[model samples]
Target: MDIVLGLQWGDEGKGKFIDLISENYDITARFNGGANAGHSIERNGKRITLKMIPSGIFMKEVQNVIGTGTVLDPVSFKKEILNLQLFDHTIQPEKNIIISKKAHLVMPTHKLLDIFMEENPEYTTIGTTKNGIAQAYSNKILRQNLRVGDIWSPDFQSRAQHILYRDYKMLEDGGMIVLPALEEISKEFFDAVDFLKKFTCTETEIYLNNALSKGKRILAEGSQATMLDIDHGTYPYVTSSSTTAAGACSGLGISPKKMGEIYGIAKAYCTRVGNGAFPTELLDEFGDDLRMKGNEFGSNTGRPRRIGWLDLPALKYAVMINGVTQLVLTKADVLNGVKSVAVCTHYELEDGSLETVSGTLSENIRPVLKWMNGWSADFVNMKSGSELPEELKEFLSFLEAALEIPVTYLSTGPGREQILKMK
Candidate 1:
């Protein structure tokens, strides 16, 4: 069985939930996104940021794999592995994890392009992390990218020289001054490639499929949310890759028949990173409280996130795309002290029309909110759905009713033990 999520924005506490569920699965594979994803898991009272690595890596029995559709930031990935090694000595390339050889490598020039694009003040900013994810994917689609397998080829140096010359010429043509060659760039790139070779697998599709035929359970994890999907999300502000459930199949090389359960994850409220149209966003003191209480900041970029109330149009739209079988609501406790809360049940469009949640309507309309009394109760150390405050239960019930999905999992805090399996 494969469990997939991300009904809301990127930081839906996916890492903690995936870590909690990893014990039941034989393999955990991350399908999409790049190092720009910030999945933080708290275990043994310690918090770790997992970018390229799967959040399930901390499990002793779980085998983690990075799928081909994901763009590789080898330097960041190497540092993450080394950081994990600091806590446990048993993690090694040959024993626990694997990387797809087909994954495109992120070059230094990609980072430069990312920075240049984000720093252009005249253009509308998409609030990127400047992590070179867009540039890496762009090169891949342009068919000018270098993959993991190319690092060991005899022509690697020549290929590098050719790529550098092309990139430098393009920058010069754009009237931008280029920096001098630094040895650190080559050293980091080569070192990352060498490190990745230890775990590169050419036939990830065959490996995963064969394992599935044996009835081995698998978990397909997504990095960003459906609202950030490039083709389906709000235009000019979405991520570079697909962030929906269908992406799970294309990203992991899995068949639709192999997909067992789809879990859509959302917070009790909503939060988004970068610049975009947020219909239900709160700009008052209440929004400030949600930001501070939830520690709502980008895990990868450390940028402050935009806080808002629940948008049902967005949630229902995600449900339709992912075919969500179950819902996992995170940070419900963050709304504990509020006097009242709001959920956007419908949208008021610019054309004076009322529409249900659709991607196009979301871009053109403003939300129509429904208010409810807030729940004031402490959820810390609480372990079960029965123990939850009555008001909190009411909130979840409303969410289920509005989205027509069951709420099976609830997360109160960042720690592993904080999750409650309600269903």
Candidate 2:
């Protein structure tokens, strides 16, 4: 299977790229993360935000699979399916979507735990979406969580109750005084679980393996990015799961030998949600302009993203780590009308030495920038790279040279048709 994922933070426009490319593959599978990672897609003039569902849901011919690594929130998953049906009556999720039975469920108690952790002063708040993602994963590792297949068991309610009360007790012991209405939460959770019974839940790993044996092609899509990987990303600030090409193996139950082309997506500039060290961050009006022009807001939280110039050093790190075969540049049109643009080519340390991504975890590392002329040409009507402005071409050329990867696609706008295939 081929792979596509974000090279930077979570919202590098993976949804748009995957949506546009899903038609070529027989299946599109999501490997990591959960409801916390939001992918926005604009198709047929309607914009929809997907959390648990794969971005390829809009494609009827493509089967979408939620792999084992994801934390499934039945409530939110139900809402996403209903929203899609509301937008297009012909889109049937029940027929097209597959859920791995081994996938862990994100219970109501997990959401409460998330809120408690974020609010607690003793712990560091990594600016989570409070979506219960981390808590659900924690429960999975602790072997105290319910899986999608567990709902089929005759004593499902009993098992669920035991875990719920256990979590409630733990929360109470952790200093929480007033608890929310347990009955109401339980009803909603079970109701959503009942709603979830309509879809297909099976051993996706075996199914995918059989499909591969039959010569079927799959596209593995990931949520979040390399820098947000739980193991490889910025510590304490990273997400709860892996977000790299290597993750696709364990997440989707595929072998490393089955891997194909890996596509890494990044924006023209940089924008990050939540709190983290961003060396190239712009705290001035120039940053505001990028935000306003790009409409840089968190898809999951709607919070204003921290904006910065493109950090090539970090991008290079992502490239090397993921072994990205091709690079997809997004939001290039956001830079339109600017007189000049800059990229952080290197990081300068306090010891008067230059570094690349090695200094990303170090404190007080200064970004060394390389400036270039910006483009103002309208890309709305442009169809190919030949129509691109000279300045923009120069920018792409520079990225190709610096990163040593081909720039294969450019997303000029939010619409599905706005992407230009650049080889």
Candidate 3:
């Protein structure tokens, strides 16, 4: 089994790559995250934004699975399944898509808890998506949550009610002013769970292990990115679950030794959603132009991503942490027609020290940039490898030299055919 995930922040154009190469794998499984993730893919002029389902759904030969490590929100997942059903009448979601029985279900109270916790003055506000991801993971760690398989149990209602009441009682003490009656909210929650129960769910460990034993090609795709990992990322601003390579093991119940090539996806320019320390942020006119041309907006929250120059130091940090085997650069064409392109090589510390790797750029540190002449090209019109732009090729070469990882794939546009494989 191989792994493909974002090397930068969340939206690094991973969905396009997943859709691009999905035919090579028989199975595509999402290890971490829930419906909060937005992976946009443009195929045949149709733009599809995948939230909970695997990006390989478009490929009829691929089997998509949502793994155990994810905290699933039943409402969002059910909606995605319904949409897929409408899009393709032949898509038997029960046969093609698999849901892990061990995957924790997102409770309605978890969503409320996330809102209250992130908005509370007593705690740190990480500008979460308010999808109850943090709260759901909290419940999982505390051993007070329900899994997807719980829907089949006769005691499901009683167990869900107990958890709901517990969450309500905790929020009530926290000065919650307005809340619907517990009976009403709990019923809705149960209904959502019931909607999820219509799908086929099972223990994935045995199936995944059996697949590995049979040598079936599996592509384990991860949501979020290494920079958003809770343990290794910029803390207090990172996501609740693991977004690194280590996540594939725990999240999928797969042995680390069973892993193959790890492909890391990164955009030519860096972009981050939500709030965090951004060292190479461009608050000028050029930043706005990148946003306009690249359409740099959050696929999920619709929030404008904080634009910045590509940070080599930051990218290098992600490459090291994820042990990225091969690198894929997305949205290279987005940098076309710009006056100049600057990459952050290092940072100047407040103590008069120079650091190549970024920990956190909290006001005291400033990025040291290396500027290059902006290479403009109409790569979208190009059809073959020989038609690749000269200046763009040189830029990729420079990026590869600095990061010490090969540039294997370069994406020219939004469409699947726009991607250029390195010769």
lDDT of each: 0.82, 0.90, 0.85
| Candidate 3 structure quality by residue, lDDT tens digits, 1-423 | 889978777799889899889999999999999878988877557776788899998888889989999989887787777877776667777777888999998988888888898779998888889999988998899998999998889998899889888889989989985377788778777777888877778888778889989989899989988888888777778888898888988899999999888899998888998888888888999889899899998998899988988888778888888788889998878988776788889898888888887645576688898888777777868766567667677788898888888988888887888888885
**Model 2 lDDT tens row, 25-123:** 999999999999999999789888899899888888999999998989998898888888898899989999999999999998898899899999998
| TM-score against native, each model | 0.96, 0.98, 0.96
Q: What TM-score does prediction 1 earn?
A: 0.96
Which sequence of candidate numbers ranks them by TM-score, best first? Answer: 2, 3, 1
Give the range where candidate 2 is weakest over 10 consecutive residues by summed lDDT: 355-364
RMSD of each: 1.7, 1.2, 1.6
Q: Pull out the clashing pairs in model 3.
A: none
**Which is the better candidate, 2 or 3, if ranked by TM-score?**
2
For each candidate, how many residue pairs have backbone atoms clashing (under 3 Å)?
Answer: 0, 0, 0
TM-score-best of 1 and 2: 2
- Candidate with top lDDT is 2
Cα lDDT tens digits for candidate 1, 321-411: 8899999999888888888888988888787888677675345677888888888766786878999878788889988888888999999
Candidate with better lDDT, 2 vs 3 = 2
